[model samples]
Target: MQYISAERYGNSYRNAEKKRYRDRSRAELVETVAETVFTFCAFCSVLAVASITLYMVVNGTPAVFRVGLKDILFSSTWKPVAKEPSFGIFYVVLSSIAGTAMAVILGVPVALLTAVFLAEVAPKKLAATVGAAVELLAGIPSVIYGMIGMMVLNPVMYRLEQRIFARTPGHQFTGGANLLSAALVLAVMIMPTVISISETAIRAVPAHLRASSYALGASRVQTIFRVVLPAAKPGIATAVVLGVGRALGEAMAVSLVSGGSVNVPLPFRSVRFLTTALVSEMGYAGGLHRQVLFTVGLVLFVFIMLINLSLNRILKERERQDD
Candidate 1:
């Protein structure tokens, strides 16, 4: 082969280098744009949370001071529009806690068992059908749940209420919409979330773990309960935390069935939860009345934040112990 001239060789080398440079530049530009977009999305999420937190704090704190912190928090009176408007929310807070707890109690076991069935026992076709149904349930609007609760569950609750309290002396009737009815509705509302997430978590447990358990002479049920469940504990806990959050935060569905009364959270008693407090009275609320509603929002926000933090900490500790 003939040797190339220096100028020609130089020109060829430069063109190759230019082509590589252009390609690299294009790739870098794409990467930079992608990074920027992702960063912007993340920033927007953070900003949204910060804005809500700030707004709640700003709107909520002044009302507490105006109403007196102890009176607002500890007192049970909630006659917002009465002549001597006492603005206590103790009972509302209690009702929310009781309702959420009751919902969790009724919902979590069914959700966990259903999740286990879907993950470990169900055939593929059956699992798919059930999974689709669960997703559909999740997708159903809160208002629809409320409507169903009002139409179907309320009458059942009313009949049960009459039967249970008819013999009790001086027992007051709660019609149909009451704490128990609301809790039942909340349990149903929260189930899909718990089931979907728990199923996902259980399915994520490695096949090798199941195989190893079987090799050690463990039955399928034993392996699922002892090995797979332990491995999937974190995810299950996360699901439960999310479910609890959903129950606590629900406004529309709870408001529909909860009777919107500021009473003690007895099962047969008509009552309002913290979420319903805001939902029921935000309209026509003026001045300190409106501010008090915002205060309720802040308290709810704090409750959620505390619960999430506590659950997260427990999860971390559990993980560490397991490790």
Candidate 2:
């Protein structure tokens, strides 16, 4: 009887040990799997950023060196087909600048007003509705915006320009598709971004600041311009930068509205922006022409980088000031 009992006990102990070992093995496998997944996710993110940046740098640098920075930017002629293609990228740059400037001029006020209305004036329900609309606009595809410009806004602008010039004789309307038209369209496209960012910035300013301004017998307008905007300068600057970046890189809408002529900027003349140049010609271009287009893209990338860097520095300084 004693021998049988001992054998049974030993069998039971062996089985328990086996079960414990299996559970530990499963736990280790789960941990390993979790770690591997996390590592993979991290690697994917790094690879994505690195690949895009690397591609831009590699493709763009050669164009920059080939063009000789000064001549490429300042040269008047951009004939890219000769024994030696004299690639001047300035015409597009001018168009981009003009369009961006017009966008800022038109967009800033409307954005500021919309932001103020949402942040300070509107009731919660009204604000929610308006904010939703702004977000919807932002989510709309660029192609759709371009289509709208081509179909609706372009005609309207054309008529308006004719009327304005007719009434004011010798005030040349230039053409329907010029800097003014492109800028206006760009302004419309970037409005949502500006409004959304500016509103958030304004709303973030301490409520107490406005109340204090009121206590000091300040008008609403005064409080807004003086207290709110100044205090929210950093955030507003960020919003402007964001808007500028969008305007600078905009291709489809600008392409549709801008006359796509490769000429030095004339106030009333239709012209091509760098982005539009790429979109319009990339389909047909090959060899050196293709490289030139890529180089234009590189120039655009550099502009965006500069804006981002400047914004970051300004924000950092603002944070330091606050500290």
Candidate 3:
């Protein structure tokens, strides 16, 4: 070979080894830092959730236990204005349940259908547009929804009383701000929640599953119902739980539309929900009245926790079935 310069050869060889070593060192540092960051973030998030829940429980438990379960839940009279007022949370429970039930009945079908259309049938451009619109709906503030219900929806319901009464026929009740109206308002308020969660669940079903179903001569609708929805059932259940939680906790929207009455409702009669009750009267409450509000908050917490626990159980069962 031609004579090579000694210094150049030595410099090139050293540079090559140095470059390789530098790369290896840098990769190791990156991996170590990434692992540390991930663990810290995960642990911090868990701690935050636990801390908040514990704080709520600490503040709420004293009132709940002292009030006794039955008196808190069954006694409908919520007069805190009297001396030595007792806390009763049953009406709140009823209101939460009624509102959540109405939301589920109205929202589930619309959300499921919208999800199906997006995931299965819509053209790409149309699907994108619709999905964006759904997300936007979900992102709109609850306060704005409350304002709209007060200004627009309340008047609308007042006008539609005759139509609603006509549909019921036997009921001669004549009031716009009532249980029915509150339920209707709650239904609208929770629609975006169901739609967003359901859309996510539907989209999570594997494309391969749908393709396999179609290859066996199933139509699109058949494939969707039999293959996609069933596979995503657990996620769908979770979505329902989440929507119910939103409906139950909704204060401003329900308060604005709901008649601010603490009495247990007749089917067409106006009534206050637990959330609305707290919000409506908190401004004027003192002493035991304040404690009663806390009790309402506690009851809502329990309701939401139960829903979440049920959803977790559902998901676990689904997982077991999958395995």
Candidate 4:
């Protein structure tokens, strides 16, 4: 029988309700602001991608149509500045494909082994040191890689080429700025990217899987190869795709080592990739010549898109299998 005034009780209850309402309002406001920021960031990323695709299409399509896609893509001659310019890019396309394939063949095994060592074999201290080195490698600029390749690797290749071809009949070694040099440089440049992604993927394999494999009397190497790698195949595939993208899009480094000559892709012979071809003449090219360069860009863009789409489908299939 503690009697309270109705007015007093009503006032207290109203104050408590008001405080709860204020707290809820503040929380809602914060949540709304956070949601808005995240949405804006996502929108910006989409907008950027859309803008780039639109720009490349708008600028590149006219050239493809004007030059005749067949002539531009399949023609062997690429004399753009001659009196009668020929805008064939058959060899350029071949060179790009060959260089990328060579880089992949040379780089992937080494990168995978290094990643496995880092993820599975190395002790913590050793892994830390090597991981730091890999990170540093990834941080180095592409131009720096080009410079190093030019100054150091080129001379070594020149000597090797001289030794190999010296015995060949009627074949003389050039300066060793050739498809092989470009591929080697590209392999080195892509190593860090492949290693980092692959190591992360390998390391992400569940601890339980490793333990279970060990419980089944599997050796460490066997467990890693049989259990962990299979589980991480999707991620490894992603790393390979990323490496391919890097190799395909690289211009400056490849141009430096590739001799910038439009020739069929031969290991010891000078060659030009699609990227190098675009870089070589875009400055002075006019009229149809400039348009053809745009077409080159368009072809490159399409190649990348196709590669990504194919890889994405593979990843999805793998995911379904995993599930």
| Per-model TM values vs. the true structure | 0.88, 0.85, 0.79, 0.87
Please give, for residues 144-216, the per-residue lDDT of candidate 2 as tens digits: 8878877777787778778767777665454577777788788888889899888988999999999999999
Q: lDDT values of the candidates?
A: 0.91, 0.84, 0.77, 0.88
Error of 4 at 63 (Å): 1.6
Which residues of candidate 3, in runs, are more than 4 Å off? 1-48, 83-86, 162-175, 215-217, 265-267
Task: Report RMSD (Å) for each prediction in the order shown.
Answer: 3.3, 4.3, 5.6, 3.5
> Which lDDT value does model 3 have at 237?
84
Give stretches of model 4 more than 4 Å off.
1-34, 167-173, 207-218
lDDT of 3 by residue, 70-118 (tens): 8888987677787767667677678778767876787778887888888
Model 1 residue runs over 4 Å out of place are: 1-30, 207-220, 314-323
Output the better candidate (2/3) by TM-score.
2
| Residue pair clashes in candidate 3 | none
What lDDT score goes with residue 248 in model 4?
95
